[model samples]
Target: MPYVVTRSCCADASCVLACPVNCIHPAPGEPGFGTAEMLYVDPRTCVDCGACTTACPVDALKPHTKLGEGELPFLELNAGYYRRNPHADRTPMYVVPRRRSVPEGELSVAVVGAGPAGMFAADELLRHPGVSVTVHDRLPTPYGLARAGVAPDHQDTKQVTRLFGAIESQPGFRYRLGVEVGTDLTHADLLAEHHAVLYAVGAATDRRLGIEGEDLRGSVSATDFVGWYNGHPDRAHDDHPLDTERAVVIGNGNVALDVARILTADPGTLARTDISDRALAALRAGRVREVVLLGRRGPAQAAFTVPELLALSALKDVDVLVEGWPDGLDPDTSEKTRLLADLAARTPAGGRRRIVLRFLTSPVRLTGDTSVRALEITPTELYEDEDGTVRARPTGGDTQTLETGLVLRSVGYRARPVPGLPFDEASATVPHEHGRVGPGVYVAGWIKRGPTGFIGTNKTCAQETVASLLDDFAAGRLTGPARVVRTRTQALDLDAWRAIDRAERAAGEAQGRPRVKFTDAESLLGAARAARTART
Candidate 1:
């Protein structure tokens, strides 16, 4: 049997390098590796050496027979990607040689976020065998979205963090938890202590609904909505005030589908998953029915992926209605008609939550006094300019008001300017040339690029940033350390983190789950410190 790559696979493709027998195809240097949704392991060539499992940064690789219920879909998913192309080229396995000599100059570096991007950057730097890394995060927990943003049913994807845990466990790496770079310590201060600073703080903020009544009670941003349901440390105990029966979601992305699915999912079915206690409680009490996902353009302009669309269409007992396609939409849509056809046909009749795809419509204004009452929608036309740019034009044909209680804006993600850093407000990112944003400072993740690509995309981004920082250090651009340790910041080392991980796993097993996260700064720190006493 072949090893399976789980759902939470962030598309890092680190396993391709680790597999000794060259079983995994499209290695990082290949043309398809960058854009491919996830890596594929060739079952025919596998010697079952288990090296891929050991080298995986986020424990995505699992022996075929050991696959759990949630992981079974990935086996088919990985294999299916390969069926489209025959005779795909394969290469020798990647080997990281141990370096005997160390680079001279200020080699210590600091990474502000410990997400996949930061960890991958650190992992790449560690390959140098000299760079000392100190990772910092605002939350008590380290991995940003891997532990928070990803859905709970995506446990296999979450496993990638275990590989990150192993990298963090390596010597010369330090984790400073509960630390906000700009708030807790100044950029200049971090620069003084380390040769350079790489800001890997992923886009934690959400884009907004520019329409009126956006501040109403039921209005939510998909960023916060994802965090709330996924047990983010900040929202673990918070009450979700979703009193709306009818919901309207703005935008058409994977996150938009996630919010709709969770809101429409059966609370009893979700109880078995690792949903936050607070979100689960709110879901149990909520009486939501119809969920309308609004897209301003036609079906050909949807931002959602084909697989994600298929997943949403396959949802059990969910009524999915498409406004434009009911009369038989064109099969070859600039908008992926194949995905649209799947969505139109697969919905179960008389489903509990109705998913209405409202296309050719734009939100002009929001309605209601206390909570959102309805949306004022105007008909729009997809305009293709001479240069092939798509624009939305008002058709002046129909205007409708949609009655709803909740409005979620999933337009996109925006990168926030770290205070005191030079921010390009228009792009919502730091201006940089090959990861070198400025002297003594660098950027990674969404802050480097404008909320583009999956979690693993950050690895190359982080590598670019670290490489620049290392280049500056070698050139004698950085100064010596100062007596400015960010006091409020507390980072847990690998040893302390392992203790916390064990405790959480044990706690989760007791509750008949894989692992129950601590979900807060106090509890995580308490859990980590508890390990010291118990070990003593």
Candidate 2:
């Protein structure tokens, strides 16, 4: 049987390079590679060599025969790509690029984030001889979003951190966790000791609804909700209201679906995962029974990816329903449309909890005296732009009110302005040319690209940034001392972070969980300090 790419594919494209048959569609330079939801395998060309299985960090590749009932859709999804976009030439194998060599002297670089992008950039730089990397993050723990942003139930996706752990183990890799770039160490401070500084800080803020009553007590951003449940230090103490029978999410992207799924998921199932204690406890006691995901656009233009939709559809003991589905939406329009049509056609299983996918609805205003009581929304009409982009325009008729205690704004994420770097406010990103901001200054990941693409997407993004930095270094454009730099901030080193990691894992093992996280900075720091004291 041919190997099939499953839902967990991270789009890192490692399997594309490993495949001897060169069957994977949308390789790095190929069309649609950048925007592809997940990499698909061309079943006709796959040789069943099993190389991709080993190359995939998340184990997303599996034989077609071994697919479970829920995973059988991916086989067609993989084969369907070829039906739509067939490759005429498949003879040439993908060649690995030659490793570039740097100057003879030691090259010290500082990466100003511990996210996937920063880690990937550091890994790429360390490929050259005489190069050293010091990663700095404001948080005490490393793996920014990979540790805190990913949904707790999706542990397979989190496995990418193991690959990051290997990168951390590489010689010359160093960490200065809990040190903020602009506050703790100035950009000039980093440049003074390192040959170049690469900023991979991700998008930190969520886009606002800009509607009236948005500041109501029960209203919150999905970003905070995700972080709260995932144990992000910034949102660990956040208390989201869950006393209502229904909660409404304002967007239909994967994050929206994630929040909806988590809200309606079985608390017992979440207990086995690494969800924060506070969130788990709240969920167990909460009365939320239904989550309504509101999409401004129709099913054809829904923002949630197919993989995420499939996962949400497969939720055990959860009834997935579609509301406000347009009258003439053709099920044959796309895979997403087809899946949504199937969902709309399903008979309600009378599951314990429910998730409603409501389309073509735009929130007009939040209604309440002190807290959110109802959401007023208007129907939208879809139209295609000159650039072939689908957009929704509100129709000023028959506005409906949804009664709910909680409202989550899940429009999207925006990159915050870095203190010392130039930023583009309109785009919410750092202005750059091929990841180059200025001489010896560079950027990578969401901060550079404006919060787009998947976790593995950062691999290629970091590679491009590192390439530009290396080019500048090779041409004598970069100027900095090779000496070590010291900071007064009491940052957590690699050993300190490892100590906290061990403590979390040991605690989780006792409770039959993956890892029980320390939700707050105080607890994390205490754990690290306790570990150090024990060693002493």
Candidate 3:
């Protein structure tokens, strides 16, 4: 049997290079690689040598026979890709891009944001012999979404940080944590110290639903809700009320599924994960039993990827149900629709906790007093345009009221305007031509493209930005700094970050869980300082 790519696939394409038979479809340069949900292994050609498994950062590859009940679906998912989209005339091996020659004299780059995009860009730049990178972030810790945005239970997904750690170990890489680029050190200041400044600052704000009573006390954005559970320092102190029997989440994206899963998952199971202590306690004490996810369109137009939906179906002791599924919808339309059709056919296991996948619905208003008490939702009708595009509009029928105390808005995310950077209001992104904003100024990640694609999609995005920066440097468009720039903010260095890491691990070891994250700036800094004092 061949190896199968599972849900945890990060789409970094590292495994694509390791396959001796070149069985992985949609290699880096191939079509759909950037937007693919997960890379699939061609079972027919796979030698089962496990080379791809060794190269995978997230351990997303598994032997076919060793697959668990939950992972068995992926076997067909991988093979189905080959059946639907065969790659017969493709190159036998991936053609590696020619390495660009390093420009004369040493080159320095300032990468703003220690997230995946910034780290990937830094890694790309450091490939050149004479390149050096200084990464800066507002947080004391690094790995923005990987650490704080990924759900705690998905430990496999979190393993990508190990790759980031390897990038940090590179000789020319350094971090200036706790320093905000626009505020603490201006873009001009960085330009004076480095040859170029690359902004990987991701979308920082959640898109709001323009409805009545959205500002009620019990209502919150899924971004903040995920942050609260994931130990994000900014949301560490946030209070989420879960004292109701049913909680309503508005939206059908992957983040919506994440918050719903976390809300309904058994507290005993969550305790073993790296969830914030406060969130775990609140969940244990809360009375929430059912989470209803509202989708404005039908199953065909659902925004979440198939992998996330599969994970939702596999949750232990939780019943996944489909509500308000439209009539005449074909079950064979797509994998997601087929799965939903199967879910709609199943009998509920009568589990105490359940997640309702409600379709063809839109929240017209959030009915509440000072706090969220109920939600008024309207049915929606989906229509197809001449261009084959599907959209939803209110049906103008009777509205139903759902009594719930908590309402999480998971509509989407938008990029906030960075100080001193030109932003396009319509797209909520920085204005740039192929990642170039101006001379010595560039952008990557969600800030470059709008918030779309998977985590590894940023790799190709960063590679393009780095290529542009290198081309400018080779053409003498970049000028060396006139003077050295200095900042008075006390920034955390590599050693300090390592110290915090050690402390978190040690504390988690005592609790028989993964590392207990420091959810506040003071505790993180204190751990670093204590370690520094001990060395002295």
Candidate 4:
């Protein structure tokens, strides 16, 4: 039986490397690699080695024989991918080149943000023998988004942390937890101490709806909600009012789906996952039974990926209801369009909890006396722009109001400007030419290109940034740390983080979960200090 890539897959492409036969299509640098929602295995080229199962960080792959009911659709999904992309080159195995070590003298680099991008950049830098890398994150814990941004139920995706752990164990790799670059150490300070500074600091804020009553008591950003449920220190104590029976999410992206699923999903099911105890308790006590996702465009133009829609469709406990598919909307033209059309075709299962995917509707204002008690939305019409792009235009005739106490906006994320770095207001990204922001200054990930693409997308991003940095180094550009500034706070290293990891795992072992993270810097540092004391 062939292994199938499933809904949880984030397209990390780890399995692509592990496959000896190179049956996996659209590997990095291959055509269609960037746009693919998820990688698929060719059932025709079957060899049941099961190497993919171990490599997949999200447990995205499963043998056809052992496919569960929820995952069964993936079998057909995987097969259909090959059928659709018959012309795709699957014969040639793409082998990653071995990185050569630096010839002489130590090269020390500082990477800000311990998320996927920063970690991957550090991993790349560590490949060179004479390179020493230090990662700095404001949060107490490393693996920024891997720890807090990824959904709690996606434990398999969290498995990427193990790989990061291996990178951490490598000689010359270090980290500074609870250290903000601008506040704690200036860019000049980092430049003074390291050959270069690569900022992978991710987008910390969300795009706003900009409608009235956005600051209402019940309104929250998906970023904050995701962070809260995943034990982000800043959002651990967020007071999200979940007393309403019906809620509205003002976007149809994967994050919106994630928030809707979490709200409607049985708290008991979430309890088994790594969801924070506080958020779990809130969910358990929540009265929300219906979540309505509002999309300004039609189903075909949804920003959500096909895998997320498939996962949403398979939720056993929640009924997914699709509303407002415009008549004569043409045939299924793309994979995402096909999946969305399929969603439109399914009859609601009439489950107690429901998630409504409302299309062609745009929010105008949130009306309430003191807080959000109702949402005013207007119908929108689709029109082709001069550039042949389909765009949504507000019809301005019909207006509908939905009574919902809670509103979570999931429009998108915007990169916050670093204090000392050059910023581009248009893209909300640091201005750079091929990842080189300035002399001996670099960037990668969301901060470099705005918040977009999957986790594996960062691998290429970091590679490009590192390539530019290395090119500069060869030209004798990066000379050493420019200046060293003494700071009151100590920068935590890998050993200290390992101690924290051990402590968290031990705590989880007692609690019967993967890991019980220390939410705040104070607690995390306390654990690290205690671990250090024990070691001494």
Local accuracy by lDDT, each model:
0.75, 0.89, 0.89, 0.84
Task: Report the lDDT tens digits of candidate 2 across residue range 1-536.
Answer: 48888884668778888988889878877888767888988988888889998998777888998987778888888899889998877874677675886554467788999999999999998888779899999999999899999899989889989999999998889999999877777888898888889999999899999999999999999999999999999998999888899999999999999899899988999999999999999999999999999999999888889989888877768999998777787799999999999999988878478999999999999999999999999999888999999999998889999999999999999999988888899999999999999878999999999878888889889888999998898788999765566776888888889889999999999999989999877889998897678779
- What lDDT is obtained when candidate 1 is compared to the true structure? 0.75
Put down candidate 4 lDDT per residue, 1-536, tens digits, no spaces. Answer: 47888764556567888887778766876687755778888887859899988887667788888887877878878888888876445564656656756854468899999999999999888877788888998876898888898888778678888888888888888778778888888887888898889999989999998888999888889999999999899998788888999999999998999899999988877877788888999999999989999999988889998778888888887878888787787646766667666767877767489999999999999988888899999999899999999889898878999999999999999998987898998899999999999778999999998888888778878878998998898788887765666655786766678788888888888878887877777778888787668778
Model 3, 388-483: lDDT tens digits are 899888989999999999999998889998888999999999999889998799999999999998778888899889989988988888878777
Residue 341, model 3: lDDT of: 91
Model 1, 1-536: lDDT tens digits are 56866533455656777676777766766677666656777766778888888767567678889876545656766675567544355556666643423464237788888887788878877767667888888776778887888777656567767778778877778887777777778777788788778888877788776778888777878888888888887766665556778888988887888888888888887776777877888988897888888888878778776546656766657887876542344765532566576566664577367888878778888878887788888888887899998777788877789887778899998888887688898889988878887867888888888887777877767667767776776677776566557555555666677777888888878877877777777778888897667778
**Candidates sorted by TM-score, descending order?**
3, 2, 4, 1
Steric clash pairs (candidate 3): none
Better of 1 and 3 by TM-score: 3
Error of 1 at 229 (Å): 1.7
Query: 55 in model 1: Cα distance from truth in Å?
Result: 5.5
RMSD list, candidates in order? 3.6, 1.6, 1.4, 1.9
The runs of at least 3 residues in candidate 1 whose Cα sits more than 4 Å from the true structure, single-residue gaps closed, are: 1-8, 18-32, 39-106, 326-336, 484-486, 489-499, 519-522, 532-536
Q: Mark the regions of model 2 whose C-alpha exceeds 4 Å error after superposition.
A: 103-105, 482-484, 530-536
Using TM-score as the yardstick, the better of models 1 and 4 is: 4
Worst 10 residues of 2 by lDDT: 97-106
